[model samples]
Target: MDSTHEQRHPHRVVVKVGTRLVVDADGLPRRDFLNRMADEIRDLMDRGIEVLLI
Candidate 1:
């Protein structure tokens, strides 16, 4: 392993986006929120974190 590489401790993460956060008052999917969350999840994956999305 390279000296500058980060070591994984837990090695995995679970991301549960609640219904309230994922939907509008009309029960529709919020595009902006979903896009933002997707970006964040991608970032975690890029960092070598295993993401379990629900």
Candidate 2:
């Protein structure tokens, strides 16, 4: 990725979520939040957007 102010071309985006956010405070998986996130990502994908998550 370039850091120049006048040249901003992002061909891809990566979103990183920590385990605490993706999981419960107790360390359990959060299905509801995951589902909601999936929905939102799908919405973006439908618009021809590409997302890379880790």
Candidate 3:
């Protein structure tokens, strides 16, 4: 796939990460999950998508 051709116009997005998805049973942030989520957000940003995390 040609990444350069995939560039998109900037847009806004509101992503609400659920408590359960972001925290563990002990009420601690899950590093691995957070890392993955960060990657996803980065990708979206790179695609010119403005992400608003809640």
Candidate 4:
């Protein structure tokens, strides 16, 4: 069910990205994963959410 009330978004978001998350087991960087993450961050910003990527 959907609420009849207004929806609110977060004022800010802090993302702590682990090196291992964006890297392969053999130590190679994962470009696809990074691109997806970047897109997500951009979406957040579009919704007026301040993103701090670390």
- lDDT tens digits, residue span 1-54, model 4: 234333354668899887767674556568876877789999999988899978
Residue-level lDDT of model 3, residues 1-54, one tens digit each, is: 465655544477888877766675566678976877789899999988889988
The candidates, ranked best first by TM-score, are 4, 1, 3, 2
Arrange candidates by lDDT, descending. Answer: 4, 3, 1, 2
Where's the lowest-lDDT run of ten residues in candidate 4? 1-10
If scored against the real structure, what TM-score would every candidate get?
A: 0.58, 0.55, 0.57, 0.62
Error of 2 at 41 (Å): 0.5
lDDT of each: 0.75, 0.71, 0.76, 0.77
Per-residue lDDT tens digits for candidate 2, residues 1-54, read: 457732454445577866757675556568876777789888778766688998
Candidate 3: residue pairs that collide: none
| TM-score top scorer | 4
Model 2: runs farther than 4 Å from truth?
A: 1-11, 22-29
- Candidate 4: lDDT over CA atoms? 0.77
Identify the runs in model 3 with alpha carbons over 4 angstroms from their true place: 1-10, 19-29
Error of 2 at 36 (Å): 0.2
lDDT of 4 at 11: 67
